[model samples]
Target: MTMTRRYVQDLQDGETIEEVFLLVDKQLRANRNADLYLLATMRDKTGIINGLMWNVSEESMAQISAGDHVQIKGKVQLYQGSLQVIVTRITKVASDNLDPEDFQPTSSQNVSELLEQLKSRLLGIDDPQLRSLMECFLIDEDLMDSFSRAPAGVKAHHAYQGGLLEHVVRLMEMAWRIGDLYPEVDTNLLLAGVFLHDLGKVREMAFEGAFTYTDEGQLIGHLVIGVEMINEKVAEVEKLTNEPFPVETALRLKHLVLSHHGQYDYGSPKLPMTPEAIALHHLDNFDAKVHEFARSIEDDPNTDSHWTPFSPRLDRKLFKGAN
Candidate 1:
């Protein structure tokens, strides 16, 4: 493959650049002289850089739109220590030319391997009834296909295809490690909690193109949707076995998954009360925040360090050190 030119961070002052980027946002504007300006967010796998189309022809405005993949020739200039592109020339590329895989961020690990590892862990769960339910979801062909392509969050950690699997696998790993740390906690319960906690996300968030909430998502939300799935699946298991899992035990497991987010504001309608529930809440949030930080690191690799713009997830700036 031919090497594409670098963006502003990769260029020195007075050096020019060319690149392919996803146009995530776009708008036209007026200058003091009422001249036209195009404002947009351009993103590649490495990071996003704000761009401007200053004094461009009216004909150019007719061609560009947000979410269109485009190729641009531009000059790199530093503005207040952040990189900005002053786009001079542009070409709209076929969507296939800018592969979603090339631009969307994903887990920096093999997804299939992670899924296998997750399966192996599930196999080790000792609780027979919980094991059955876990097995059903893990092996459900359709569900596995969706898990393999869905993003865990729209813009946070594991936000690409197969993101849901990656996030769940990571959380399960943590839960298992916690089991090793505290043998008093029932490992089966912990494992079951980890797998089922986010199951509803498959239905809650539509993965048709980009990750966005479905009508169900806006109506029921992931928490409510999730608990309901667990209930439905649990009922399936009961039908197969001709009996129910212990009410108290099943309730505790459901409670952990339901309350893993830890607050109503965070989407957890209930608070985590059991030790397993408490552990899950922290681990899930911990993985998400750490993954997001890792994404921030991937941005502006040439810089020794700089304060990132306010992160909507954290509502603060992050700084990086020399790799």
Candidate 2:
């Protein structure tokens, strides 16, 4: 029988069940206490649940590593108005028993729906060469599947499956709105840059169950990959015409991707120097930072002027509104 999911707050004196979860982070407890303990985040389709492995032993660690799929047997407990799992036993699921799709966190946006949205956005770009390059890959069934399934970032922001597309769509929306405000930012160029900025992320992440950076990603990172992607696509499209993709235009778009991080200290090789690049940088950061605050509010509800820790992605502190 499929395991019945019981939230950590739903336990009676002795209720038990098996659960699958993405272990966000893990480490050995400093003191070697009698009963080993593990803190992990458990989730199904609904949302995440705070879990605890109260009876963790060396045997448990031997079979499962962080980011592995496991069937944990535990009873739920409520503490300080929060729900937590008190694990009595755990079974590391074999690769044969586990399905990668079931364990990966996905977006609520239906795959078909999001794909349609992406196609529509692609059609909206006005540059002839940019549109052709976009059409080249967006029409491929296999590449489309991978792009939609990829996570936007390994962890920082838009970390859920299909998050890459979601983040791009959001950036596109912001770019369109910014276009309304400036009217001189060259909407076509800005739109093209926004869609392609994270396109290379599809190659950057290696998703077995939980998404993580591939060797290529760790070595060169997404910015460099994106610049390379633009160059290749430009070359492929240039074959159709005797003239090559305009050097200036390609440089402008590549510069935006490389500098979206905003500063040398923050992974950007150069700061956003162009008007379009500066706008993309701030809007992208705004969307990511806003979502970080949203996650913090969901996880920790006690909002009475607590000092939110520094958000590495936003490079700022998240402040919660008080009750």
Each candidate structure's TM-score, on Cα atoms with residue i matched to residue i, is: 0.77, 0.78
Error of 1 at 291 (Å): 2.5
Model 1: weakest 10-residue lDDT segment is 1-10
**Cα lDDT computed for each candidate against the true fold:** 0.76, 0.71
Candidate 1 lDDT by residue in tens digits, 29-106:
889999989887776655567788788766877887766777887777767555788888777788864567666655
Cα lDDT, model 1, residue 220:
89
TM-score of decoy 1 = 0.77
Write one digit per residue (lDDT tens) for candidate 2, span 1-323. Answer: 15554433344443556666655445445345555677766544334565667555665567666666667777766455345677766666665755555556777678777778768877878788778877866766776788888878766677778888888888887788778789868778787888777777887888656566788999998899999988877787788665677889989989989999898988999899898888888888888877767865555423444645555545666666554
lDDT of candidate model 1 versus the reference: 0.76
Worst lDDT 10-window in candidate 2: 5-14
Best by lDDT: 1
